[model samples]
Target: MVKQERAARTRQALIQAAAEVFAEEGFVTASLSTISKRAGVSNGALHFHFANKGMLADAVEAEAAKAVRLITEAARAWQGESLQAVVDATHELTRSLTHDTVVRGGFELAGDTTRRGEPSLRTQWRHWVEDSLRRADRNGALAEGVSWSDSARVIVAATVGFEVLGGDDTSWLSRQNVTRFWEVILPRLAGRQDLDRLVSSGSRPSAVVPSAERTSG
Candidate 1:
């Protein structure tokens, strides 16, 4: 049991270290040795956890995908309007991008043309956004003449843009920035009744605590 727990910790640490290295140095340039060193583990330990750099990257992307799923799920759990749930999820996502190295790295990797794989993180997010908007439409939360497809496209583009820009300047991931974006779009996206109730600044304080803090706490 102790060995299993330690192995889990080692794998997690390697994933996190790989994320940091990949985020700072593009996946193509990041070295497995660097990731292993960053994790404070020997190269043999890293190899035991991940066969190669691609495997490590995959692990990082998977961890990030989990975080995104949790954020969207939490947002949908909200008791308020569906559109409001979208807004809340957007805020949570940006918060994760800003504070979570794994998330940020995974997003970066998703866009990295150097790597190719099935259903990147960006695809996952886009799909979720589309599904959520579709739900909102069924709930009559969207404005007249607004198609969920168009709304989902715009939201996905804007959020992905923020993620790309935030790589250089984290201000792009700021709550204020996300709030301002929703403030401008929610009026056009939400139905009259929903618009009045929707808070462009998010419905609650950010629940995306840093992964390290979450694990420790």
Candidate 2:
């Protein structure tokens, strides 16, 4: 039992180390040696735990799932609140997921055609977003004429769009961009207008999540 516990800890350490590196350096440029070094493990130890870089990437994604759960759990805490509060909470949950390292990384993974069909981490994510929005719909948060599924689709897709476009050679995605996108989309889903007045454009925020959340597989 102790050996197993230690092994699991080692595996997690390697994954966390790799996640930080891969998020910062991009998959193509990231290296096992660096991951091992960051993890404070010998290269052989990382290889023993993951077998290969691709498997390590998959583990990194698993970490992203935990991050999604963090936001999902937070939103779920609003159990029986008012429709507006619930809607706002649920909207905040989606924003949390998008703003997270693992969830954002999952979007980049979903967009990668090569990685798209490979167990698609976004499958869980898509379900989470769609279901949460559906809950809001049940609470009458959406516009009277709007379809929850459609609104959910639009919100998820737009978040992905921001992740794709807002990154550059110097940075990953911007939190301000993601947050602004959230503020804009939430009003629309609720059938309210005034996106232009939410905040002035061209305002950028500091990085919050890991870059892997914004980069592709």
Candidate 3:
């Protein structure tokens, strides 16, 4: 048990170290030796955990995907078709990107053309937005004449734009910015009657759940 726990910690340390490197330096420029050194592990240990730079990047992306899935699944598990849930999830996603190196690196790495086998984080996010908006449209949460595809395109584009812009200026991911975005977009997308039901502040009950509780549960 002790050995297993230590191995898990080592792997996590390596993943986080790689995320920091990858987030700071693009995939092509990032070096495995640097990641191993940053992790305070020997190159052999890093090699034991991952075969190469691509594999280490894959691990980082996988951890990031786990984070994204947590945010999206929380939204999807909401009781009904809710644009509010989507709004909340977007805030969560942005928060993760800002605070979590794994998520930020995953997104950055996903855009790298050189990483042949890695999944596209943007594509996953776009599909989720499209599905969620379609569900909202069916439930009459959307304003009349608003198509889910159109709404999805706008939301996805804006979300990615924020993430990209935030890389240089963290102010882009500020609570004020996210709330302002929802304030501007929600009114146009949600039905008049449903407008009040949405939260522009990006608050979610799920936000109150402790990270340890979430990870354990």
Candidate 4:
């Protein structure tokens, strides 16, 4: 039993260490040796816990998903908020999810993947984001006449763009600089009117666009 508990802790440590390193450095440059050192484990131990680098990457993604799901569940569990409050709550939830290190790292890794295909993990993230938007729309927080499913898709796409391009340029995510994003995009979405109330002052500007992209210049 003690051995099992120790193994679990070691696995979790590697997951966290890998996420941190991968997010800070592109996947190509992120080394298993660095992750092992960061986790305070020997490289052999890492191999024992994870079959290979790809397996560790998968574990990192799983940790990230769990972190994001927690934020989603928290927003859903809010019992007393009104429709506007709910939208506001969801907005906050998404912000936390986006900023989460584990969740954020998965995208950084996928972004650096050389394979010319979709990562299955990306579909899950998109579905989660879409679901959040749809829930807000169904609660009547969004304006009428907008297609919630499509709007959710667009919002998630826009979010990905923002995260990738806005890297260090938080200027776009600021209230003063990013209102243009809403000016151009909000009308197409369902919850603009409700969001106006929820995000009246403290709205997150936009997703942070990635800065210093290693590739895709």
Q: Highest TM-score among the candidates is held by which one?
A: 1
TM-score of each: 0.94, 0.67, 0.93, 0.69
Candidate 2, lDDT over the whole model? 0.58
Candidate 3 regions off by >4 Å?
A: 205-217
- For model 3, residues 1-217, the per-residue Cα lDDT tens digits are 6998778878888988998998898989999899999999999999999989888888888877778887888766763568987887888888888878888999999878797565588888988899999999999899998898999999999999999999899889877898999999988999999998788976465463233433332
Each candidate: what lDDT?
A: 0.88, 0.58, 0.84, 0.60
Clash pairs detected, candidate 3: none
- How well does candidate 3 match the true structure, expressed as C-alpha RMSD? 2.1
Q: Give the TM-score of candidate 2.
A: 0.67
For every candidate in turn, the CA RMSD to the true structure comes to 1.9, 6.7, 2.1, 7.5
Better candidate number, 2 or 4, judged by lDDT: 4
The reply for model 2, stretches above 4 Å from the true place, is 1-6, 79-113, 169-179, 191-217
Residue 162 CA displacement from its true place in model 4, Å:
2.8
Error of 3 at 7 (Å): 1.1
Error of 4 at 116 (Å): 5.7
The TM-score between candidate 3 and the true structure equals 0.93
Please give, for residues 1-217, the per-residue lDDT of candidate 2 as tens digits. 5997778778877776776676566766778999899888998888789889888888777766666555455445534322233333334434544455545554445455555567665566568778777876776666668798998788667645545654342122444454565566656666443233333222213222333542322
- Measured on C-alpha atoms, candidate 3 has an lDDT of 0.84
- Candidate No. with top lDDT: 1
Q: Quickly count the clashes in candidate 3.
A: 0
